[model samples]
Target: MQTFACQCGATLFFGNRKCVACGCDAGWCDVCRRMTAVSSDGHCLGPGCGAAVAPCGNRLAYDVCNAFVPQSATGETIRCRSCQLTSVAPDAGDPQNVHRWRLLEAAKRRLLYDFQTVGYPDAQLTAAPPLTFRFLADTPEKHVITGHADGVITINLAEADPVHRETARQQFGEPQRTLIGHMRHETGHFIWMREIEGQREDQSASVFGDHANPAYGDAMKTYYDHGPAADWPARFISKYASSHPWEDFAESFAFYLDMRSVLDTLRCQAPQLVGAGAGDLPTMLKSFQEAGVALNEVNRSLGLTDLVPEVVPPAVVAKLQFVHDLFQRYVAAT
Candidate 1:
């Protein structure tokens, strides 16, 4: 997360909607990823209004978007690129839509934030379609599923219901489940498809397992029918990872990011982390391992699980090395 400011120079926080100092609304200008001040008036960001409407449609209609839709788009009623994720948004005017849409937007913004920090390319990298998401309302005629396709990720609006989500969590025997977790886990799948497949996929196969070794469709059927393997924890990060190779990759990817973020968070509290960033792959892993041990001891003192599951095993370490090499190469090229 990065700090932002309003036009008045007032400091703002991530996910803020309004500016406290100048009484202005805080909006994200997706074009530059900068924060803009929105006027309180109900006006469009169209050229006709000029800068007269301070809080532009980009902020008013959608909480925050990647970029401001230009005035020409208003006449066509086209969706903004960031908001395009939704294949379905409940009627904005509907009472239920207010609550659900806000929840969806907040979760989506967090996903975008993490994606930005990591520089993970979008589906455009594969000459594939751009991704989008939708909030689908359940009806007698159809059921909503939460999954990603070539260009869209559709989430059933009912998943926002606490009771429903809690029920699913319990049935799955997960310790924690939230909108953010779903977005993180699902985005892992998308990233695997867009950025980590092909050559990278072959490498993952050598470490994780053959990508096609498991019959996915039937593997899932067997999982639910027979339950998770008894030794799942020894080999998998979570029960879902036992489903298939693709799933194992997604779970691993999510865990990698989770571990990185949590370690970064702890570094803020412990100054020893200051020197951890200055290193190559082997050096960095040593730093991470040291930090993990110290952090795990602290967790045990407080009676919490080790924040990270385990050290990168010898087999998995090489795959993570590949990822590090890829990023370093990319950085140098850029």
Candidate 2:
């Protein structure tokens, strides 16, 4: 992510809640899409962005968000776009839940920022049903499954507990798992609903196979009955992606998002890599591969988990290309 400059001439980060250099209250200003400093009287101090602003309700109530909503004429505090999409928030009475809620909002804001930059509607988190997050803890009578159904992306609160998430990641043999990953993966389903479900079934099914052939429930049951094939690396982006065609698409979409994020960071932090066609898929992937090797080796030297995957299979590249093209069309049509 690109860093912003505080009015104090200090670097400001995306999620920073205050300017450390000048003790000014700070929050992300949606109008300017900048790390904004605001005066005590609610006037935004972002360059060329002097609108009135107020803290998001969650920021005021639980200190979970570092975002501002346009100040209401009635002087009522409101949720920011990201906070508004949270249909079911974690219980705030519990201290741990409050912390977990903060983590969730931070991740959500990152995902929304990426979406906006990439030309997706979720950036605004404008409505419900088609896209929303339901963060629920498991109850004695109910288990919160982390998946998308009818556009609602339900997350198990336990995923915010690093220990629990790590244990589950190891159990499933996943390459990586985090709150942001979940958001990207789940939104992949929403993308399917928007871009492919009824409009281009033949084209999508030709690439990923028919999503409804065996039925999702049947496919999921069979996947658990027998693990992924040994040759899955050649055909699928992840082991879980082998469960069904829809899953394959979601996994590939998630990978594409992840790849784009890495490439963006590289471009911002190391501008020397920018060349003609720098934003093109193949060019970006080639650059990422070269950088990934160095990044992976550096992580090894530090005895840390590899920061990037070693390779992207040709099959997965095709899937990524599909995702890229879909968004290109999405952006153009808009």
Q: Report the Cα RMSD per candidate.
A: 5.2, 1.8
lDDT of 2 at 117: 60
Looking at model 1, how many pairs of residues clash? Answer: 11
Residue 128 CA displacement from its true place in model 1, Å? 2.0
Off by over 4 Å in 2: 122-128, 273-278
lDDT of 2 by residue, 195-237 (tens): 7888988888888888889899999999998989778888888
Off by over 4 Å in 1: 6-10, 36-58, 62-80, 122-126, 196-198, 260-329
